[model samples]
Target: MCQRGIKVTHVSKGSSSTKIQRFIPLANGLTDNMKSFAVFLLVLRYLSVSHGCTCMEGPQQFPAVQIDAGQGNVVMTDGNNYAYFLLGSQWYKMGSLNLKHVSVGPAGIWGVDLNNRVYKYVAGSFVFANGESLQQVDAGGDGQVVGVTDTSTIHCLKSTIASDYRKQSTLSWTTITGGLMYFSCSSKYGCWGVNSLQNIYFTRVTPSTCGISGWIQVDGLAVMVEIGTDGSVFVVTRGGEVFQRQGIDSSTPQGTSWTKIPMPSRISHVSYDRGNLWVVTDYGTILKCLY
Candidate 1:
């Protein structure tokens, strides 16, 4: 048997009244072991609540056909072939460029031209980074760029310039693999990709082999996957459903169980940074997702 005491204080008219004390007895079925387990679970719940990720909905009237966030900046490409970047809350036009996909990260802004060549935005102009052409490109912090070729081969830019954003001559391309349709990377949590069959794969970024390895299968199907700086993962399905999971960890590298996020419209693209989640609907409506 166990008894726990709790004190309740009451006040009347801003004056202290009486202090009531109560003792609650534990249930007969609860043994000392059960009590200890319950206490452990309570501690875990409190920790998760205090340190877990949070999300909220943001502006609904953002002007862009597609949007991405990284490196304390939000970038969007409008329908007019114009690229706009957001510093703080204001949008600045970065001029016109023929880019089908654009991504911003600590490495700066990267775009893929109609011819599939990769270009890095520098000094108000897009400079060619590498000769290898790709169909899609995603930039990550620490000057990492990953892309998929027209033949579905995955390629990553091997940088010789280190952190220098100006020198494009120091960039070269290396093929990671083939048969991947989409890819995204987080400097903190490596990179993730989805193949033509909607299969997911992950490669850890480390000093060994530039973090490229044979594709490891992970559960879930996604048309797009975006990773936050904190390693939070968000995925958009072909059926327009948005789901999220924590990043790779010792217990669950494939991530925690997926949770469906409610949205007002069908999501066509998704991007996450820190705790903020952004989605663009099929109708070109942009919204910040709150969880």
Candidate 2:
């Protein structure tokens, strides 16, 4: 079990984009940044007792918490790091075994709210893309496991499993963020997203003539909001706007353009994997973005 302070209250929350960076209040005291939690992309952070991740050792093992996975759905990673629980009320640890969404993360997190309790994890914990885990195979005999499945979010356990990926995703991807659409500059890819309704699409820099032109708007949904980087796309009204984030992926390894792609699966959700994008459509069809 984890440490729990009785009678703890007051969970502080704020927008990191437009104000002074602040640490969230824990059940007992002020949770210092880089002290008790890991912040990536400044979008979301999981609750843990220790702050600052161990790069050389990577993410660690817990003492086993309560998960509760369910029926068929899917989970995945950006092939990088991911967070599982929001960690409020109390912070606990598991026993070495992670309740990963799929086998890994970077794809994105999900939630199962049977009683209306929303949570977060990745896409692969519950299912994977049908491809075997490259991390596990490369690890030789470390006993690492991964998989692929539809991204329907049939359960709540997927997010918990993918949370551990953060340990290994350290070397690559300057930062990781939970998002519907993403682009990268280091890789020279433009963007990865679905429409306002969840349609999916992938596009990139055409410079003179790399063949692909104007951010491609594939079909999709769940592409709620997006900001661009320089030479990137706009976020508002399809006019003069850009999706840029400072202090987070500032080097801009993310998408700059903001065009909603189409989703073959009407009910499908989106996830990012090392700039390699993946999504599940309404028809239970899985899609990937090829640069």
Candidate 3:
């Protein structure tokens, strides 16, 4: 999903005054003229790398394989498939069940294990959601959840499935037409997905009954796609390029064009929520980006 040979340069945001003061103490063991030149070079190097968006290393960057964020909640899995949930500034390990892919949204925190078993976070543990099996499941949809099986079949949670965790109700899913290798949903503008052919498509999904309209093909090829809660769409192509949907609103759901978002290194997985863009790089680095 990513290439090599590019060294990652970490860029962080700071006050202009603080940046100048940071170099004040580095003038030791140098002539007055040499100190000034060294500081100038450092500042210039910093400015050249800090462009587009500022990104810092995430709290826990232990080779994140998959990450999802929604409603101020962030959940991810390490290379070992151990689940974790971010609380405040610390990441607390969630349950003992190993999960390959996890998601968080209005419906709840749900995941699909290596065995393709579906589980939902209830109370403080993951509980089996009926006997459903899927390769990846997304809970970001409005009042429901959608998932794609290993065979690329799409299914959505039944409307009867309550979002409340305390209910602990037996969840069921209804199959949706169309095959998708990767899919993401938003409460506002429905869902967006990418098929095995790398074709991008969109559909209006009824949150009430998990009903979906016909697929509307977009003019692009993407390996994966993610829909932000605020109706924003972001996609990563097969070449590890990231782009955001431009001019998207209530009227133009498909948007007009794509605006590339600069990244220091190649990224495999990306999740956007609020104003933060979380990405796992090719070399197993998780960066929290602010635009």
Candidate 4:
């Protein structure tokens, strides 16, 4: 039958036309082997000669809670099992990722990538996967969507349902004069932007209370910053000094307070996950905040 232009070769003559099935790419990137009757085919056009694709062979799993993808990776979960993966440009099923996002959520539900692309799993549905360039493209959900662009702009897309994802509240913010991966937003009130100067700055962005304010330089070259749910800012700087800021009426590092997490080392990324905080050290060590 002519299904979406692709010929659906009847694998079974006895199979009814109404029962005819077509191979539709998995929307959440999962191999059929993990479940039962599914297949995930990958086509790498660019990184094939460079960073080869790493395929995972296993069963579909769920997460304990939820997960957030970073730049170019995808997160998958079966409600109790969690998996994160970074595929160059190919396709992968559930439980095939490179890093873990214990901070954003459990380890599943949804995921972010290096390019800031996010996706959700819709079982039994065929979905076309997008490249990392699709960041800030679209997510099929409501709620607040935080999008980051490669052009040093942090955009906030907020809706409120699981299906009304097309109507996003997009607010773009430019980074400081320094080059950075752009700014990271919080669903709370504002977002923090890391500038090209390797410094950290964030301004209020809420609607009623959020006015068009300029950047507030926090410090020099923070390794990473995670805004808490209570409007407090936790910033990690060059020397592993963990600084916390309370409100906008503070000068930062001093206006609020500065307390270093006694890790005795520097870290690459500090993530908050599963009620605890995890930090990846510069030497590839994963350290947890002693809270």
Best by lDDT: 3
In model 3, where is the ten-residue run with the lowest total lDDT? 1-10
Candidate 1 vs candidate 4: which has greater TM-score? 1
lDDT of 1 by residue, 163-276 (tens): 465757646566675578888887775678888888877776442234564566778998878776666777889999787775457455567567676554567888877556
Candidate 3, residues 124-169: lDDT per residue as tens digits? 8898776568999998888688999989999988544747534445
After superposition, which runs of candidate 1 have C-alpha atoms over 4 Å from their true positions? 1-63, 159-162, 165-170, 207-209
Candidate 2 lDDT tens digits, 63-161: 111111111112322212222331332222212223332222222333222222222233333222221221110000011111111231111112233
User: What are the clashing pairs of model 3?
Assistant: none
Clashes of 2: 80
- Candidate 4: segments with Cα more than 4 A from true spot: 1-94, 97-117, 121-142, 161-163, 166-182, 207-214, 239-241, 246-255, 273-275
Give the runs in model 2 whose Cα sits over 4 Å from its true position. Answer: 1-111, 117-256, 260-267
Error of 2 at 238 (Å): 16
Note the Cα lDDT for every prediction shown. 0.65, 0.26, 0.80, 0.38
Error of 4 at 115 (Å): 6.3
TM-score-sorted candidate list, best first:
3, 1, 4, 2
Using TM-score as the yardstick, the better of models 2 and 3 is: 3
Better of 1 and 2 by lDDT: 1
What is the Å distance of residue 164 in model 4 from its true position?
3.3
The best candidate by TM-score is: 3
